[model samples]
Target: MGGSEKHAGLNNTKLTERLETAFPLLFASIGCIYLSVKIFNPHLKNKTKACIVIPTVDDLILFASHRAQIAQYRELEITVAGLAEASLFTSQKFYLNQNSHINKNLYTTVISFGDTKWNTQQKSKTSLRKYKINDERATHNYSIITKILKPRYKIVKETRNQKGKIKNPEYSYISIPISKELFCDNLTNGKPFYTDFYKLAVPNRDKSGKLKYRIKFEQKELNEMIEKINFDYEAEKIFIKACHTAWKHRLGKLGSDSKKPGASSFDKLVARDFERLRVALSKSKNFESFRETITDFWSRAGRIQELTDGWEKVMILLEPENWKRGRDLALLALVSYKPKNEKEETALKKLEFDDTKGEEDE
Candidate 1:
C-alpha cells in the first residue's frame, strides 16, 4: 500500500483484487478491523456499504514476512537504547541472537532524532534535527563499549566579548574511539569488570546533582591501555590487581584522616599517582629501579606489605620491555574500584599506614 508509483505501475487488476481481499483479514487478526460503525454528527447520513474480505492461504507468507520485518524494526530500537545505557552484555547477546552468522566487520548505527517546536496548525513549520552515530563497533567488550557510550563534548571556538570572558561558550557532542584495534579485536572479554573501573573513576554527582570533578583519560592514553590489555589473561590480571591496589590506597585505610576524602580529591590523587608512575616507568632502566620506585610509592601510602605479597608477579610486569603496559596497568589499578566484602573490609582495616607521614606524602 505504501509502495512508490513505479511499483504501483506494475500492479494488475487481479493482484489489486487479491490485496483488497486480504487486507480485511490481516486487520481483523490484529483487532484493527471494526465490526460496528456509528455516526455522531447531527446531520442526515446516508447508508454505507460494509465490505468484509477473507484472506487466502497465499497471503500467509506475506503476513509472516511483514511480521518478521516489524519485529526486526523494533529490535533495532532496543539495540540503540542498550548502547546508550551502556548495557553491552545484553546488547551483544541480542546482536548475536539476531545474526545467525556473525560478520567480523559489523558496525552499529545510532540515530538520535530531535526537532524544534511544532506548531499545532502547521506541522511543516517544525525543523527536524538528526545526529547520526554509525561508527560504533558491534562488539561485546565493556571497556570499548563504555568508551563509545560515555558522554563527550568539544569546545566550540568563539570570540571574546568586551569583557575578558567569552559571552557564550559552546560545546558540541563528539565521539572518539580509543583504538582501531578495539574495533577489530574479537578476543576481548565482554564481562562487566569495567563497571568497577567506571564507578571508581567517575563518581556520582554531589548533593546538588552536579559533577565536582572532571577526571577522564585522553584518547591516546586509553588506546595504550587497550593495546596493553590485548585480551591477554596475564595482562588482564595485572590490570585488575592494579585496580585493587589503587582502591586500597585511595579509599581503604590509607587516608590521612577519619573522614573520607571528597570525590574530587580522590580523582585528583588517582590522576597524580598515575602520572607519577608513568614518568617513573619511562625513566627506569631496569626492573630493580622500577621496583624501588613502586616500593617507595606504596610505602608513602603504607602498602609496602601488600606490595611484598605480590612482588614476584609485579616484578615480572615491571620489566623494561613491558614498561608501557606496566604504566597503563598502574593507571587502571589507580582508577578502578574493587568492592569488598565484610572479610575483605576487615582485612583492609587491619592494614596500618604510617601515622608519621601526612597525606601530602602520598
Candidate 2:
C-alpha cells in the first residue's frame, strides 16, 4: 500500500509539472487565434502604425528575414512597396523565387512613373511629405525609422560641413539590423550572404572566363544559401569595415594627400590641365590688340554691317585685337568700306607724321 501511494504521488507531481510548463503555450495559442480573427474579420482595427516600406525586391527579401519577430506581433502590418523601372531585381518574379521567412502573406505594390517602372511603390504620401520637409530633418527621421525597423536598407549619414553646418546625407548603403540571438552563429563567420553549407561548398571562379560566374540554386539550394548569408553582430561589423575601406578608396579623398607634393590623383591632374588652359588664354596677345585693331580697321575703310555680320571670324583673323573689349573698332571698320590703295596708305602715314610734328611744335 505504501509503495502504491508513493508511485501515485510521483505520477501526479509529474503531471502537474507538465501542465505548468504547457499552460503558457496554451494561453499563447489562444491569444494568437483571437488576434488572427480580429485582424482578418474586419472587426478589430490595427492599433499600431501600418509599416510602409519601399524596398527593391532583393532588399525586401533580405529585410523580411530580419523582421520575423515583428511579423509575429499581431498588431503590426507590413507593406512592401517598389518602383517597376528602377528596381530590376526586386519584383514579384524574384520574390516568388525566394521563400519568405517573415510575413509570408505580405503584399507588394509596384509604382510606375510616366512610362518608367519603379522598383518600389507606396500608396501613402508619407515619403513625398518627407521629401518636402527640410532635408536634414527628413533624413534624421528616416534614419531613425531604418534603425528601428531596418526595413528598406537605406543609409543616412550625420555629417558636418567645413562651415560646421550639420546635415544628414542620404545613401543607398545596404545594412540590416538583425536580432542578436538569430544572427550570432553567422555573425562569427563574417559572411552576411552565406546561408548554407552548400553555398559555402560551392566552387568560386579564381580567374576570368568567357562566361559570367553564377551560382544556380533551386528552392532547396536557395533555402540553404539564405541561412548562410544571415549575419550576426560580429559578421555585420566585419562587413561594415570592408565597406568603409572600399568607400574610402572610392570617395574618401578628392585629390592626392596635400602633404605629398607632385603626387597627382585624377582630380589633381584635371585641375592642372584646367590651369594650363587659363595660362595659355592669359598669355595670348590676340585678345589684348582686338579693340585697337578693330577701331583702326574701321577708321581706314570697312563696312560696318559686313564687319558686324562676320564679327567673330573677323576678330579671329584680327587676332590679339579680339581680346580687347567693346565693338568700337568693329563698328568703325564696318562703316568704312573703301578698299585701301597704296596712295591711301601713304597718305595715312603722312597724316600720322604731320600729327606727330604738330605735337612736337606744341
Report the lDDT tens digits of candidate 2 across residue range 1-362: 12333356344453233677666555432221111101111111122112222332335445455344444643222221122111111222223333422223333332222111231222122211010111222222222222332223455777888987887665653322222111222222232222222221122332342221122212222323223332233323232222223222322232334236666654444334323322232223455444454354244332344444444444443444323222222221111212134432232222111222121210
Q: Estimate TM-scores for all models.
A: 0.35, 0.16
Candidate 1 lDDT by residue in tens digits, 1-362? 22333244554633343677677645554421111111111121112111111112223554455435434543212222111232233224222324433323333322222222452221121121121222223343443544443333456876688887887776553333222222222223332223222222222244555432222333334434454443434545654455456556644442343336553443344444544554464455566665677556565655544445666666666667655455445544543333355533333223222223221111
Candidate 1: pairs in clash: 242-333, 243-333
* lDDT value, residue 235 of candidate 1: 45
Specify the highest-TM-score model's number. Answer: 1
Roughly what TM-score does model 2 have, to 2 decimal places?
Answer: 0.16
Candidate 2 structure lDDT: 0.28
Q: Which parts of model 2 are misplaced by more than 4 Å? A: 1-81, 84-113, 116-233, 242-258, 265-362
